[model samples]
Target: MGDYFIKALACGDSLRVITTVTTETVREAQTRHRTWPTATAALGRTLTATMMMAAQQKGDEKITVTIQGGGPIGAIVADANTSGQVRGYVTNPEVHFDLNAQGKLDVARAVGNAGFLSVVKDLGLRENFTGRVPIISGELGDDFTYYFARSEQVPSAVGVGVLVNPDESVKAAGGFIIQVLPGADDAVIEKLENRLKEIPPISKLIDAGHSPEQLLDDLFADHDYRVLQKHSAEFYCDCSKEKFGDSIAGLGTKEIQAMIDEDGGAEVTCQFCETHYQFTADELKALMH
Candidate 1:
């Protein structure tokens, strides 16, 4: 009913699947950013991928995904941690367009296909795991599939979809990630490839009131799968007044004083959740020390 994702391994551990139903999450994001239909589609896809990627990790692990295409939508950024929290924003959320030939949201045109998709993961290591790949489709799903194959060397199929209502609200949003594991049987791969080709759009599945577990069941209908874990996903931002204060402090004493002198205080709004945090001159002065 809200939003959730399930992780599982199937075909004798020769394949990995992550299925998510993200309608509510995307709705919240659209409301927060006031994203149009095309922008909503682009952002929703990226957020779905972020949720799946974070589900692969645990504890304090973190991940940041950035997509910069020269399209009207500009850049899309989403971050998630192992705690089932994800937040993101688009640089140009007001973008919209007539439906594409397929009668879809025309996400590729809005996202552009001229930039790169980058992922940075902080896994409690000295240096984070960083991956970058060119934006092949600007549709995000194909780009992420290519990212896994090209960057992580894992052959994957990522299907993310978002249906926008006439009112610009998200009608249904969801995604699935299927990866081919090492030494996978050729038969297994072939079977999965067939399923991938025949399966309906992920958004359609979610809109039909299917849960993540049910999506997996539909994908691997013939083969029995093992559920690894399930997690609640939502539009979550960790920004706070103190975090904004620290950022203001990082701007140094002079910038803090300038905020106090020029504006009498400071107002900062987070791009991810559109949450605003205000600090008065008194608060700014304290950060100056």
Candidate 2:
């Protein structure tokens, strides 16, 4: 599929597993942000993990994840909802470095080891649920794994990866999340952990053309699992001229007049998508109310 994720219950409903292939999704992000290989890998991993996290929520619920690692890449932010729509950006998109000892993108170096990962769940409540944890591994996958165990208090394993081609284009991007539910059998958890250790990296699996179903099958090799749901996903941003216009209007008439007099117009670019929206002098006057 172009881009999609699947949710399944394995080990007799004692464990919840999610898998996704996001090649095209990450490609779009790379093109939009012009991210280098290391930057692409970092942002792609964050986006994939955010999308999977959103799968756990109900209707209209949303999840926002932020990472700031005190590295050259600065902060990474991504948000997603139950509808499988995700969008994100990094503070710097051109940072890059040589591969690490394992010949990987060296995401940890670019992301740094000093910082925090924070998550906010908007459950349509009076106050959103927020969790923050120290950055354990700048590689992202381990960081998210730690997030679940410490923040949500759910024993979870998260794996996310991205591969960038020689031309700095995204080759593959995907990940998996396995959560051990209450009453999970100890033996089953041990088996699942062993299976994870044996499987290839998630990005390599995606590059090898493994579908979400196949990924779960690989993870639950000798075990039986039932697919619970599937959702189409994409790097989507809902920003619009009207939305930016409302923001400009919120700035009051005095600021609107300044744009008309000094610049003759105002150009607003979305940080996530880099899409620019221009408001001419006449348009600015229209929002002066």
Candidate 3:
């Protein structure tokens, strides 16, 4: 299936929910980054969460999520816009670890227990909005749930999971976010909480052929959920040779000449997508003009 996400409201609009299927998107990221199984799980979870959060924005608005856990996987940064475009990178994609005690990817060990998760929103305003909170759980989902309850002051539940194949490719990846809107009744919150406690992990559900709509149905149970919007999501990077050429041009004539004298050319690689752009001696000379 293609990558997609949905936004919905349940229980008379007292709850806001977002769910996504990101297996293809995560596979794209794994191929671009060549991430190990553990690294794939960590980065995939964060990317999925970022897409859901970005869906809350308006026109031309975007959101960036940073996970700086001070662990071997280093930092993960991702940006997503309302248009469903997303790009991200891990500071150390080669990192890996054995499964944890629960027979799951050891994301906490790879992400560490220190540092914070920061979020910045670009709303096309004079000043961008930013919020941050300590990384209470390096598992990502709990960290985002903590972020919403503490930083955004919204009671929310977040579930992000990524399953890795035997060959280290992404098998299933997905997530869900459910928030309690204002004036939600105590019974509604209690029942929803109870239901959440019984559902399987998000990755397991996706592996079982559950769509984003079905995930929401599982979350909301018998309550009717009205789908607000549906968007196709993907692992998209906005890096191009022309953009790299401009950056090389900005380095001035001296830098370009040095490259010609020392290495005979310049090779630029995008950190986000691992795409390489090469400029030969002739190309460099033309760029100097």
Structural similarity to truth (TM-score) of each candidate: 0.97, 0.99, 0.96
**Candidate 2 local lDDT, 69-98, one digit each (tens):** 999999999999998889999999999999
- The worst-scoring run of ten residues by lDDT in candidate 3 lies at 216-225
- For model 1, residues 1-289, the per-residue Cα lDDT tens digits are 5798888999998888898998999999999999999999999999989988887877899999999978989999999988678999999999999999988889999999999999999999899999999999988999999999999999999999999999999999999999998899999989988988897888988889889988988899865899988888898998899998888999999988888889999899998899999899999999986
Instruction: At residue 147, give the lDDT of candidate 1.
Output: 94
Ranking by TM-score: 2, 1, 3
**Which residue runs of candidate 2 sit more than 4 Å off their true CA positions?**
none
Residue pairs clashing, model 2:
none
lDDT of each: 0.91, 0.94, 0.92
Per-residue CA lDDT of candidate 3, range 27-111, in tens? Answer: 9999999999999999999999999899888999999999998999999999999977787889989888878999999999888
Deviation in angstroms for 72 in model 3?
0.6
Candidate topping lDDT:
2
